[model samples]
Target: MIPLTLGEVARVTGGQVHPGSPGTEDLRVTGPVVTDSREAGPGALYVARRGEVADGHDFVDAAARRGALAALTNRVVEGLPCVVVPEDPDRLSARPDRPPYDAVTRAFAALGREVVDRCAAAGGLRVVGITGSSGKTSTKDLLAQVLPALGPTLAPEASYNSEVGVPLTVCRLTEDTAYLVAEMGASGAGHIAHLTAIAPPQVAVVLNVGSAHLGEFGSRAAIMEAKSELVQGLVPDGLAVLNGDDEALVETMGGRARDVGARVVLVGLGERADLRATEVVTDERGRATFTLTAPGLGAPEPGLRVALQLVGVHHVGNALAVAAVAHEWGMPWEQIAASLAAATPRSRWRMEVTEREDGVTVVNDAYNANPESMRAALQSLAAMRRAEGRTLAVVGGMLELGADSDAEHAGVGALAARLGVDHLLTVGEVARPAATAYQQGGGARVSSVADRHEARALLEEELRAGDVVLLKSSRDSGLRVLGDELAGVTD
Candidate 1:
């Protein structure tokens, strides 16, 4: 925060100072802006909203006692300095099911936009926005590590890419903050656009267009349109880094990127890409080693060899995208390569590998899932298995896939069979299609369980000492918990 006064907050959020408020116009918020009252501290502003479980307005006094400077709320607290945003009675009547505290959320977004604009105008902050179907979190984690080497950087802790999550991330920016890496995700059009309005970006990275939200958007074309919004919302003179290997992105999004008037840099394994990888190979642990080439630079050398600490060979493209962004910002090729090689998975349950003392290896990639990412994980698992070693895949349902859900699930099973996984353990009723497909496809061994408990029981009985187990599924499937349990990891 850059020290905005209560009066300024009221003005920016279309709010009014309440008569019961404790402070005058000059009382300012100098600490971080937080939605949870428990995060409030000296000079902090607590934003209160009515949620499904509880109303945040009830915590105003607690926040004040905890050293909060004031409350930004839909209604005022008697002893608290508050900025109250008026509710729309028309909206309330039109949509009776809408939460009454939505007015406060709208105001909070506006406040975040104001603060980001203020910081950018002061020449102290640059916002980098990234969007994609599957790799948003992974690539954001990659950039988070590299960007911090340039300056103080802030990014979302996990998959905090929703509307509220975007504003919450923006509110974390400070006066001396140099970089804000925002991971933008969308299930439909206009979601990323709205997030961009809150914290506009100077550099935008669109990783890929995939089937992650096919149910919501209806088709790959629709998903492409949604993901392209990130680049379309870029500031004037901004740069767009795109995945050239994705046909949907290259064909459909190239014109959109041009229309947005942003300089575009294509990144992938394609020979025509501005930033591309070649001579790619994955080692025994499924880590990738590639020759990264950024052509047309004035320097004598245009290629750099990179061996990523990340597990999947698919991450070569991700590293290329990160290198393009860092390159645009003037980071040397050697620095970018070194930073990428030094980076590992910071977010849990996405290719998190653990080798127990008993010689059993566990791979947890259950953060979320889709057809593309499921196939990628299966391929990586196949690469890690030795001729004498057994491989078991504990998979769950991939949700939000709409009408093609069953077919997609079956395809994942077929891929696992093609990759020669020794055992295919499909967890939950929704994922039974995978087991059926694998059995019908002549896959050697398969099992289906109704829940995590049954899956864990069967695995405990079947798993061998030297076997490698891969746990993969959508987040709601609870496969990550089972993976951690099998690995004896507490947190």
Candidate 2:
């Protein structure tokens, strides 16, 4: 964050100054803005949020001890200079925990907005917002790596694509930051709109809208409406990148871009796409090699061949999206392909493949799941060659599918069965529909375990030296630990 005095923060957040001393309002915050007191440091402003089990107010002294500049809270502490705002429940209730939490978030968002606006006014900050039902994180990782080749860039650590995460990414913008790659996500309508207001994008990339959050959003149309908010929020003459392969997205998002008078770039496998890929071939490990052609970037070179080390053919689309952004910035095709070919997955747990000493391969995609990603991961697992070994899917529940949860799980089960998976292990009861579907599809070996321990035991007894296993579930499912332990990523 750019240097802001306690007085400026209070004014921006519509709060009052509750200084520990007489003249501390002039104290400038020049470092990061953090929510947890433990993350506070010199020149940091600690946002004291009230969680379910703990209150952040209790740690004000701890933050002060760590050289924090001030605290943004509703109540005053003895040792810390505070910016006190009124406690309002309705504004702060977007999350699971309940009142002053939302107030703190609202204030924190305002501070972030101020910082972003200041950076934009001073020049050299280009915010690129990426949103999709799936592949947001993967595309973000690609863009993060590609952008830094041009200039200094800041992207979220993992799938930090929520309201709070967006603000945190925005606040990380220093004066020297030239690019901001923000991954925006939404459960319902208007979430991305709010995120865009915090740090508006000059370049907005809308990936495909799939069944990732079908339950929260009742229908595909509604999900499209929510994801379109990114392109709608673009500044005048801003660029809107849409996926040409997804028929729904191509039609809906193309119309949205035209409606807003924003410059549009369609990127995918489509023949008429602005930046298109052709002759896409996936290797034995499910890595892709594709020929990219863009007439917009004038070069006599017919095409650039990009060989990706990342697993899965789905990443071909992600690479094209990143390539479109780089091309818009005038990066040559050879350079874009080079940077992309050299890029690896920076975010953990999504197609993170580790080959154990025993020659077993563990693909940990347990970060999050939906029907689309589940199918993709399963396909990638099946694509890997095993001479005398088999493929196993250690699957679990996919949450927030609403009424379609069972059917989606069943569809994934059918897909696994059709892909010729040797064994199907469902971790929890929520995944029973998938197990049942697998059996219905004439799958030979199918087992349903009550917990991760039971699932691990089953795998230990059944897995062989040359077999390939996939651990895929939502974040709360805790299947990632088993993958980490088995793959030697953790003890």
Candidate 3:
């Protein structure tokens, strides 16, 4: 990054400087803000992001002790003068506005953007951002793996798809990067637009719209609109890889993106899909092995049927989207097939199976959630629960879903019941409704818990040797706790 003077940062981001004086001293900065002081470096800028339970400002002293050059905050630090913030979570969260966040934060962002902008300044960054309720992480992982064979690629770690994450990824970009595969996730409006504007991908993939943050966006239509921002914000000569089966997105892109410069590439099993799938099969392990028939290219004879690692039949769609992105980048068909066929999803909670003692299968997919992902995981369990193995669902509440949160939780419960899960254990207050709905929906024995620890405590005692369990929930519920708990005991 080009070292910027404190004055240049103020000029660029219009932030307030403390001590009422400015220095031309330049600080070359890199890296995104992580709370752990150990990650902070000599020139690191620390941002105090506020969450429900923990306020990062509380850690500023710890941050300063770790060699943080500057701390962005509203309060004071003993060693470092705070960059007083205007204190809006969303905006201060973004590019660090002044009167806003501390000058260091803006300066840091400016430095990072300067680096990425410099790389893309000559022509453009061959960026391809993906945003959808269900398949973002999977799709991003797929593209990063497949595109590298064609060119150097960089995608965010896990689901780092947010206001702060997008800019941070942009700042991380070096000229050597040929593909920046970003997953753009949002709660309300403007985020997708903001992030999409930052990446300005040449090819934007809208995987599939699902009941993700319905509470935040208000409705499915709103979610669709928010997700569409990725494709809509595409640069001139950009390609929009759409899901042909997603009626909401297909109609919207077909209706509007044509007016913009975006070139549409439809991907789905539907016959109308530009990149279609055929002869899809799921193995005994619940991993989808599909043959991709992309009419967009030609010769529909044999589709690609690689063994997908992620444990969901629905992820066939995600694989297809990655194939589309690889194809769009001019990667040869055989190479695309090889890259995708060889690709393995980075494991967290998505369909992670652990074999506990006795004969149980632990389907540990305790990551973030929306209605669509919940249904997909449940379906995975339903399909695998057979062989006389009991299907157990350990579910937690989904967050950030505004007013629709309760109904969405209820919907999850209903889905679990309809899937005929052997046992349902709902954790968190929001998931109580789902538990209730599951019982009412003629589901198998339904149980409720106050939190994940309680659920684990019960599972430790109740889980039998021959059951197939599915643990799923939102990030806030800390579903990983269950995964770790199961991982610890299942062995």
Candidate 4:
């Protein structure tokens, strides 16, 4: 928010407003600001939204102490106005026949409409909403890094892609931001629609769709429907970029691209895409070399080549997505090339390598795990080529799949078996599921650790020279600590 009057807040959210100061124009927003509260300034109207175990409303008093002028919560605090919705937030089964779940979904849709209307009035922020089955974050990372060359812009700081995260990112959009790259993920249909309402993108991209939330959405078609929500909000004259490589993306998004009044552009290794990459090459170091092509566009389609701060082949697709977007914005091929080459990764966990006292190398990619990212990270390790020793993979259970977790885990485990990782360290309750798959698939030296503590203790004693170890898990699993511990670790 550039700055809104108290009346503006009421007008946007349709909420009752109590005047904070008699003549105040400073609008307040309340949300979590504890270890990270410094990010929010004074006059923030915090939303004490509930979490898994504890109610954020309980911290309302403490949050108020830290400069929240007002708090939005489900339950009424002694001195705050409560914005209550139906009790069930997760009621809306994509199944749709779930009764009041439909009603709840309608309420969220209405809320999303209000959010979109509110953000649209903020003015002049050109938003770029991004969604994918995978690589949304990496593509966002590349977009944020490149856009600065065009003008000052802010992509959401972290996993700011959900309902709560999208709103906060919008709140941070000052008049200074020329572009806002919004990442949208969907567990069900209408999620992308809700996300798009808040940050109605003039330009948007769909990286690709995958079955990330299948446990909730039930099928890949449902997942595609959910992710396609970003394009639904695009202006008719805007551009909708799709991954031509993904068949479902092409099928669902193609006609919807027409429906939104946006022009469809495609990007992929495929020869058909309007913005495509070809002739890509990578060395043992995971440094890529490639020429990009936009065949139908004529005029010898720019011969672009570059190295990236991000290590892994998957990033080529991420870079190509960013390049296509930059091209749409009239950026020169040279600047795009320069930005891609100059972009140093901000990720602390993804493909980070550190050395131990015994000269062992650890590749820390533990910020998150999915089948696609797991395969990419493993391939990066494989290409690293530990000359004297071996590649050790430490994998943990990916969270939030809801069900079918065993099969997905097993798939990654089997891939590890095929990739020839010498030692496998599995963490968490799902360790047995993956380790069994790996061992069954002929992966030797498998060790299913009791926990990170056990894995750390076990790893300290056995790691040898020239070894490349990768640690990965879902964010909830607290795997980054392993990466930090290994950086200067001693046995």
Give the count of colliding residue pairs in each prediction.
0, 1, 4, 13
Q: Write the per-residue lDDT of candidate 1 for residues 134-227, one digit (tens) a residue.
A: 8888998999999888888888878889777888888877777888999898866667887888888889998888899899889988888778
Candidate 2 — which pairs collide? 92-102
lDDT-sorted candidate list, best first: 2, 1, 3, 4
| Ten-residue region with minimum lDDT total, candidate 2 | 92-101
Q: Which ten residues in a row have the lowest lDDT in candidate 4?
A: 97-106
Question: What lDDT score goes with residue 309 in model 3?
Answer: 74
Q: Estimate each model's TM-score.
A: 0.94, 0.95, 0.86, 0.87
Give the residue spans of candidate 4 off by over 4 A.
Answer: 19-40, 73-123, 297-302, 488-491
**Which consecutive 10 residues in model 3 have the weakest lDDT in total?**
96-105
What tens-digit string does per-residue lDDT give for candidate 2 at 276-322? 88999888777999998877756335788999989998898899989
- Backbone clashes counted, model 4: 13
Model 2: residues with Cα > 4 Å off, grouped in runs? 88-101, 296-301
lDDT of each: 0.85, 0.86, 0.73, 0.71
C-alpha RMSD of candidate 1: 2.7
- Top-scoring candidate (TM-score): 2
How far does residue 285 in candidate 4 sit from its true spot (Å)? 3.4
RMSD per candidate (Å) reads 2.7, 2.5, 4.1, 4.0
Off by over 4 Å in 1: 20-22, 89-101, 298-302
